[model samples]
Target: MATLPVLGGKVFLTDSGGAKHLVKAGCDIFMSTGVTHRLTEILGFAAGFALGFEGKDATHPGQRIKVSEMGTALLGQAVAKPVGSGKGTGLSVIIRKRKNWDDIAWRFTRQDGS
Candidate 1:
């Protein structure tokens, strides 16, 4: 678990093997696998759901799922896109385990099929 500041205010990534990373921020902390780290702006009631998601390797147990500062603001507003056009307002970060993704994926696949 580590902390690194996110500057661009956005994260876009594709699926890949499991690697560990930490979001270094004073206000918030979260962890996720290298490949699965996804960020989309939180919107609607889904915003609440998004906030509830736990990021892997988070320093605080309660904050398993976390979002950026802009995320919280946009969520409260319940806007689809950011107030000003340009890019989106908030981001949604995908979280995954570093130890073993195949194991988790296979396990869930069985349950889903059942």
Candidate 2:
């Protein structure tokens, strides 16, 4: 696990099963991959196999959210600045492993209004 110090506490990040040893922020995958065409193989094999978001557009990763146009664009209705309406409102994005092709198909179908 990699711990990033926050203002009040630390945020710990971990990858229990992946190949890389050190999970430093902004680390280029190629240097740490330790396999032939490992990056290329991963890219071809999966879309969201990434432990965290892709950082090519930005300089770093993990700790700081990518502050870029595509990032902003994802938050289609986000405010001029990402300020919480009040202190209690916490924003987050959670990714979990999905099971069954039907479950996945339903999501794609819903998006298509089919």
Candidate 3:
């Protein structure tokens, strides 16, 4: 097997067998697996938000790196056929709401009318 992509110092989920991996959104595998697997959210990731991901396009191992969009909903869609050979590994990409200190402060202020 090829050396798989690893999302070090990044947010990721662990499988039942204790494998850590990062997957893309809109992938057929993710859609299917998300339904059956109970995914756990990992916290304490680096700053900035990840919006979404595109399928792997490079035929060579090092040719393609996973690309992600920032500051948007994590919605998964089907990847293009040529790019996504359905042979990709990893579980799936997960999207979480990014809340900054300002956002939190404002929410509290509104609730308390302060």
The TM-score leader among the candidates is 1
The TM-score measured for candidate 2 stands at 0.18
Identify the runs in model 1 with alpha carbons over 4 angstroms from their true place: 1-88, 92-94, 105-114
Off by over 4 Å in 2: 1-36, 48-91, 99-114
State how far residue 97 of model 3 sits from its true place (Å): 0.4
Clashing residue pairs in candidate 2 (N, C-alpha, C atoms within 3 angstroms): none
Give the per-residue lDDT digits (tens) of candidate 3, residues 34-111: 443433122212212332222334443434555533333335844323333355742234434543433432111223
In order of lDDT, best first, we have 2, 1, 3
TM-score of each: 0.19, 0.18, 0.16
Best-to-worst order by TM-score is: 1, 2, 3
The global Cα lDDT (0 to 1) of model 2 is 0.45
Task: Please report, as a residue range, the 10-residue window in candidate 1 with the lowest summed lDDT.
Answer: 102-111
Candidate 3 structure, TM-score to reference: 0.16
